[model samples]
Target: MKFLHIADLHIGKRVNEFNMIEDQKYILEQLISVIESEKPKGIIIAGDVYDKSQPSGEAVELFDDFLTKLVSLAEFVFIISGNHDSPERLSFGSRILKKSGLYIAGVFDGKMNKITLKDEYGPLHVYLLPFVKPAVVRAYYDEEIESYNDAVNVIISNEKISMDERNILVAHQFVTSGGVSPERSDSENISLGGLDNVDASLFRNFDYVALGHIHRPQKIGRDEIRYAGSPLKYSFSEARHHKSVTVLEIKEKGNVKIDLIPLLPLRDLREIKGPINELIKIGKEDYKGSTDYIHATITDEDEIYDALGKLRQVYPNIMILDFDNKRSRSNISFEELSSEKIESKSPLDLFEEFYEAQNNKKLSEEEIKIIERLLEKAGGIEI
Candidate 1:
């Protein structure tokens, strides 16, 4: 059995305040075209179908259209909701869709969904465990779920899966092996520290583990366990990532071959570090791909007049601008800065620091007010 592994579509996502709907549409079309050529038996969408839990109307339409086309290309399709999705909403008509060769696994109601496919060899079980939290699992199982590994192990143990046969597990979590986490991008909204880490050893029984949550495509511990990565470069931090879809060919139990089909984006994300004047003088012939989205780091010792304006004259889609002079580099380390800020900063300042780290810019006054209201509601703190 052959299948296409993809994840983290993040439709309706915005980068540097620019909407990516058109770019997403273009990439999805390319994906569908590839699907038509490869003609895999099925497609496994690990998680993070949309950018937000309550996706916008346009996002809903975009996903709906994609699914409509996908079901026509592949016979069996499996999808699970990620932390960014509302499970109930994603699985609204899951029962009805399953009849049409689409299996949707959203909420975890104390059980994991398993669908068995077959070839000439034997049965191939495909287990779907959507993005899970310790608290959610504890509520259902009523057990001591102290860590992510514990939660997952307990859930799979209840399923009574036979390890003798070939099994493919689809999961979305921060999977780590020997204290080493997978590569992360700025677009992924993960918890700080190691609160969400799940040991990869918990999934040793499975033949191929299709993982999500991390945007950089890589194998964890072994080649069989992999992250397909996002179809596009969502952040400047992922500028070096060669985005692709993982194609798996499972001939028999414990016998699998993997291939990564590269995905080329409509506009690439690029970073250039130099003086503003040098960047402005870059001719079209000198830089063939100047139209790509740019993150420029100006290295001039003194501040140039309207530096961004000058660079924009040459590169229209400049997304990020920063100074990399002596003054900028002579800053304290992140550990020291975070420690001092925690001791001296107010709640708002702390929140702004976190926001700026996730996003590349500080929150606006309106956005800050929204955060204040949410904090007040969650913790009953008067800000």
Candidate 2:
């Protein structure tokens, strides 16, 4: 069986405060082209389908177009809801949608909704697992589970089939050693010690594990488990990633052949740092490829009051700016600030001995009051 794997499309993403509606439309068209050219039997989108829980109409249409395209050539398509998705909204017409070769799981009903597809080599059974937090799982079971680990274990253990089936598991959540992007999680997801991290050992029973939530395509511990990454560069941190979708070909004998199909983005993301003069060398073009989104940092000796204005004349789509100062800034070093000795007699404790030798033991009323105020404001420095 041959299938395509993609995730974190983030269809409603607002890139650099500009509407990416056209860009998203182009990508959805590209995905259709891939499906028609490759003729994959099925496709799997792990999670984070939309940028917002309540997505805009444009985002909904973009998603509809992509799904409508895939169902034309693909025999089966599997999708799960992520933390960013409103499950009820995404899973609209779940019963009817599944009949059109799409299987979606937004609610954890404690049952595996397995979709079976046929190829020359028997059948492939794919199990869809959506994003579920510890609290949600506990509520589903009506029991108190200690952590997400317990909830995950319970969900996996309850599967009523053997591990040896032609099975695939799809999930969306953080796992150890995964890469993240800034475009996702608008300040809420970055809490509680980044505890969303899960271990790779959870999928030991499955034939292959398709994962998501990490925006950079990578293999977790082994090739059998992997993330296809996002379709486009979603944030500043994802500037260095070469976005891709994966194609997996599996045979009846449990032989797997996975191919990385790289997606060339409509506009590249670039970060450039240098002085204004060097940055705008009129004679040459350095960032010719990244004409869409560029973040520039000016390390100038003097402030160019309208640096952004000047840069806009050169690169019209410039999105970010920063001024870096590497000189004329003095502060105590870390060693100096943190090092204080109290094991021996402190200077204040042995004031009389130190005063006799150096003749500088005490401060005047003005100096003493200033020191007292500084200490009080500094939270009364430790010791």
Candidate 3:
């Protein structure tokens, strides 16, 4: 059984205020070209189909087109909802869609959604496990669910799968190997504490575990257990990632081979740093050629007049502008300032400190009265 594994499409994503629907469309078309050439039996999209729970009309339309193309090419297309998706919204027409070989697991429903497919070897049971939380599992199961690992283990224990046949698990989760965490990017919304992380050992029984949620492509513990990563670089922190889709070929119980097919984007995310004049020289080398989304840091000691306007003349697609001079570098660390001194200060003293930090001046009497009125309205203080 051969299948294409992809995840974290984030269809409606906007990076640095630039809409990526066109870029997403381009990449989806490229994936369709791959599907046509490879002719895989199925495609598995682990999760995070849209950037937001409520996506735009354009995003819905774009995904509809992609699904329409995939439905025609592959026999099965499996999808599940991530933390970013609204389960009800994602599973609206899923019952009808599944009849046509498009299977979607949006809500957990206290059971694993299993679908068995046939190959030359035998039956391959594919289980779709949507992104889960402790609260969601506690509503149905009587077991103690304190963390993500507990929730997953309880669910798996309930679903008794026969180990004789080849089985695959499609999951969207923050999975960890031992105590090590997966490579993360600034764009991903990771939760605090280790409560959300599940151990990779819990999935050792499956023939292949297709994972999502982490934006970097990597193996959790073994070769069969992996994350396909996001199709595009969502943030400048991920500029080093070579985005790709994972293709898996499973022959039988213990036989599996994987390959990564690279994905080229319309505009690459990059960071460029140097003096303002030198940056302009490099930016102006080709007015029409260098269209990469850039985060440039100007290192000039003296303040230049209209720095952004001057840089815009050469680099039209500059997304972020920052100064690497003394002022920016001289910012105090958070640990150096403490809440120990805060307990003694009055509310007005705290306000004055904040005002001085922001504007380099204390609040005037009139401004203080305005703040007092706002605080009174909020029930924080009396006049």
Candidate 4:
């Protein structure tokens, strides 16, 4: 049986304050085209159906239309919820939708959701394990589930998985291989110091493990364990990512083949660095991707008047404006300063110094008065 693996739709997302509704709509259309051509038996959307816990009305409507079209194209459509999604919201009408070959495993109900499908070889068991934390899993099981790895291990171990049949696991978590992490982008919300990582060794029994949460497409530990990254670039850090959908064909138990079908977006996210005048000149003269979402870094030492206005005339969709000049670079670092010097200064003096260090300029008299009033309200050190 052939199936397409996709995840992290992040519907109704906004990148750098620019709404991506049109971009998402265009990409979904392309995805539908791909589905028509591939004619897969099943479509697996691992997790992260929406960007936020409470998505906008337009986002809900867009997903409704997409899901409707998906059920018409494929025999089975499997979906799960990620950390960003509200499980209760996503699980709404799931039982009703299951009648139409749409299986949504949104809430973790103390057991893994398994759906059996028959093919030429035998039974293919597809398990849907939604995003779960240590606390969430611990509530159901008495086993000591301290970390993410322990939680996942306990959950899978409890399942009566038959090694004889071809089984596929769909999950969303921060997975690592032998203490090494997968390539990550700024868009993903990973815990500090690798606190949320679940080792890939736990998934050795499954034929394939389709993963999500990380926005970079990559394999973890083995070829069968993979992450189907987001369809569109959500940040400038992902400017180089070649977004694609994973297509898998399961011939029999322990026999699986994979392919990556590239996905093209409406407006590609990009980064451009140079003087404001040079960037504008290039945009006007030879730059073909003027409408592309851009993060522009101005390198001019002298401040340019109306730099954003000037750049917008050429590259209309510029999302961020940054500076790499001497002023920005010359900002003082507190770490380099002496601790004695810091301790000797008054609280108000320290605030003024810190503010100047950050903005490359001193605070005004009115700003000082505002800080003084705030300090007085708190009954802090005398100014």
Best by lDDT: 4
lDDT of 2 by residue, 258-369 (tens): 8987787777777878888777773147556536677888888675779999887777778898867643232323333334533454333333333333332355567556
Clash numbers, per candidate: 0, 0, 0, 0
Candidate 4 accuracy as TM-score: 0.88
Which runs of model 4 end up more than 4 angstroms from their true locations? 286-288, 331-336, 339-383
Clashing residue pairs for model 1: none
- Provide TM-scores for the models: 0.84, 0.80, 0.86, 0.88
**How far is each candidate from the true structure, as Cα RMSD in Å?**
10.4, 8.1, 6.5, 5.3
Which candidate should be chosen as best, given TM-score against the real structure? 4
Deviation from native of the Cα of residue 302 in model 4, angstroms: 2.2
Would you list the rank order by lDDT, best first? 4, 3, 1, 2
User: Candidate 3, clashing residue pairs?
Assistant: none
lDDT of 3: 0.89
The candidate with the higher lDDT, 3 or 4, is 4
lDDT per residue for candidate 4 within 1-383, as digits (tens), equals: 99999999999999889999999999999899999999999999989999999999999999999999999999999999999899999999999999999999999999899999998999999999999999999999999988999999999999989989999999999999999899999999888967799999999889999999999889999999999999999999999999999999999788899999999998999999998888988898856688899999999977688999999999989999999976678646677668998788777988887787666678999999999999888887688
Question: Quick one: ranking by TM-score, best first?
Answer: 4, 3, 1, 2
lDDT of 1: 0.88
Q: Against the unseen true structure, what C-alpha lDDT does each candidate score?
A: 0.88, 0.74, 0.89, 0.93
Residue 153 lDDT, candidate 4, scale 0-100: 96
